[model samples]
Target: MSITLVLVVVMAVLYAAGVYQMLERSLTRILIGFLLVGNATNILILLMAGRSGLAPFVTDDGRSYEQIAEEMADPLPQALILTAIVITFGVSAFLLAMIYRRWRLANADQVENDETDASVREDAAGISAQTTADDRALDVLLESSDEGTAAKHGESAMTDDRKEDR
Candidate 1:
């Protein structure tokens, strides 16, 4: 019946669900799992904060600062929660990246499923292969029979002036 008891139960349920979802293959479910776990962690921190009290900020109610300090809520727990939130954000990014990479590794195939994928990959490979250091297409195009005297730094002197042989 107590609020803390109810919160503890809720936290337990959240943690259980989050961990279960984390075991699943779907990225979206994993993301949900991360979020749930993060929230449950926040709740755990809150429970560890002890009994709640008035806000820490001082008010002009004719009370001395010394007398009010005793009832003020502990800022340390709040600060710890903020730190946890930042850590969760950073951890979530890495976790998502790891899950995505794993999914890609497991799902990706060397065998192209369709003609479009095959053609695109083949064309890309061919284009990149030509631009390698051994080919030296630019050097050949820029070379002049006159030797030492090279072309000036202008568009007309560049390889664009002539058709590139593939």
Candidate 2:
């Protein structure tokens, strides 16, 4: 098989596995997913760069500048991929640290859904009455405050000035 086809297949597999792992609740699995995705992205960049050629630097040979430019590989994609690798490494390190701290505090590798999320789901499913009550209370409070403020301030000095200008 051709190298491009092989790389494409590998990239596809990496992306598939990465997305699947990312959907899991475990931090380790998420990290693995990130790594897989990063590798897949690098491969994609390489594939898009087309066939490799000579290095992109000045040479002592007698080749013309235009010839050198034509023969040299495109540097931008390689540079972008290198920068992406460094950024990914830094972010991965930070995530690993955060995961370690979370593990230390919670003593668990799997993340549990937050109570707020559970409450939202319960509200959505019409299984919790408190949600509606809380929302109504907040709406009433906001309406009262708006009316009180409007009555107290009438109109701001800025609005009066703008009206005079018009």
Candidate 3:
């Protein structure tokens, strides 16, 4: 097969895989999907550039400037690809940081569904604002009670109680 055809096929595969991966709940898979998509886009830009030719550098050859221009490869696509690479790297890094933060906060790699999202949708569809406010207050109250219980018992009390049972 021709190189262009090969690249086109690869691009199509990457796009399909990327879309599938992006739909997953795992943040790592989403990041990988983003990378695949970026690489596929870069390949698409390269394919649009046509066949490779002489570099755009001006030489002291006797050939006219117009002839040299005709023989030279387009530089814009390469430059665009380079910019896209940098942007992809930056975005990937940001996503990685967010994943790490999420793992630290929730102790899980997969993104959990937010209960608040459902509640917000319900509220938008006519649920009263007072109900949402009461839910938030209940959450805060439960959290404070849990923290108070932990503080009142302390680590030493739990360890001693366990030792007695053993």
Clashes of 1: 0
Relative to the true structure, candidate 2 reaches a TM of 0.73
TM-score of each: 0.54, 0.73, 0.71
What candidate 3 gets wrong by more than 4 Å, as runs, is 120-166
lDDT of 3 by residue, 1-166 (tens): 8889999999999999999999999999999999999999999999998879899999988999999999999999999999999999999999999999998998988988799998888878675677788899998898678667878877333356656886
Q: Model 1 Cα displacement at 77 (Å)?
A: 0.7
Q: Which candidate number has the best TM-score?
A: 2
Candidate 1 deviant stretches above 4 angstroms: 59-62, 99-166
Clashes of 2: 0
Q: Which is superior by lDDT, 1 or 2?
A: 2
Cα distance off (Å), candidate 3, residue 147: 70
The per-residue C-alpha lDDT of model 2 at residue 163 equals: 61
Go through the candidates in order and give each one's C-alpha lDDT. Answer: 0.81, 0.89, 0.91
In the order shown, what is each candidate's alpha-carbon RMSD?
A: 14.4, 10.6, 20.8
Worst 10 residues of 3 by lDDT: 154-163
- Listed per model in order, the count of residue pairs whose N, CA or C atoms clash below 3 Å is 0, 0, 0
After superposing candidate 2, which stretches have Cα over 4 Å from the reference?
Answer: 127-166
Candidate order, lDDT descending:
3, 2, 1
